[model samples]
Target: MARKKSPTLTEAELRLMEVLWQRGEATVAEVVEALPKRLALAYSTVLTTMRILEQKGYVRHTEEGRAYVYHPLIDRNQARRSAVQYVVSRFFNNSPELLMLNILENEAIDADELERLKAMIKNAQEDGSEQL
Candidate 1:
């Protein structure tokens, strides 16, 4: 069966989601405090963005006293997989191999990281063979 498509998050929404993902749940003031200082967003901006995230189904909230405690509806790994799938389809013609090749060619992957990647590829190959 095909997987259901998840809603895409904007950069601002993702920032708010990060706070919820890390903290498990938080109030609007908490989210604002968790954000990077460079972002310089006001509490109102964070509250508005989180409300938008709720509308987009990326978050859910419970009322705590007078504040809404928000949490991520989607986990980080799920969001990462969806985002990667989007990039693969849109930019790499649905070819993950092409995407890896581009990254390997252009990015400054260190020796340790390269070895780790190779080990992962080897393990994947072994797993694939076992499944066949």
Candidate 2:
């Protein structure tokens, strides 16, 4: 077999992983079913992408009776972090502020969520300071 390039998944892969994460375990059909139309992706394309995900250690699968039960090998938060790192490094040039500002601009965070998000950010900053 050709060396399956690098296993590192891109943003697209991470999105697919989200469906698998939510479902706990899923098959190719299940994942395809979960995708939104704007994804503009074909079933075979998703299958190939997920197989690459398996090769890259982002996902795992077991033979369940006659079906392949696929699930994420990594934690959802960790996968999110990895994808964030990639985007920050590649597009945002490692500036989290840009990403945060983008999210704040495009997404709606209600007051309760805003407060919770603020608390999380403050806690993370404080924790970082403690390590120094």
In the predicted model 2, the residue pairs found to clash are: none
By lDDT, the best candidate is 1
- Identify the candidate with maximal TM-score: 1
Over 48-75, each residue of candidate 1 has an lDDT whose tens digit, in order, gives 9888888878899999899899988899
Task: Tell me the tens digit of each residue's lDDT in model 2 across 1-132.
Answer: 776464356777877988988888898888888988778788789888888888888888899888777888898888667767888877777999998988899999899999999999999999999999
TM-score of each: 0.85, 0.60
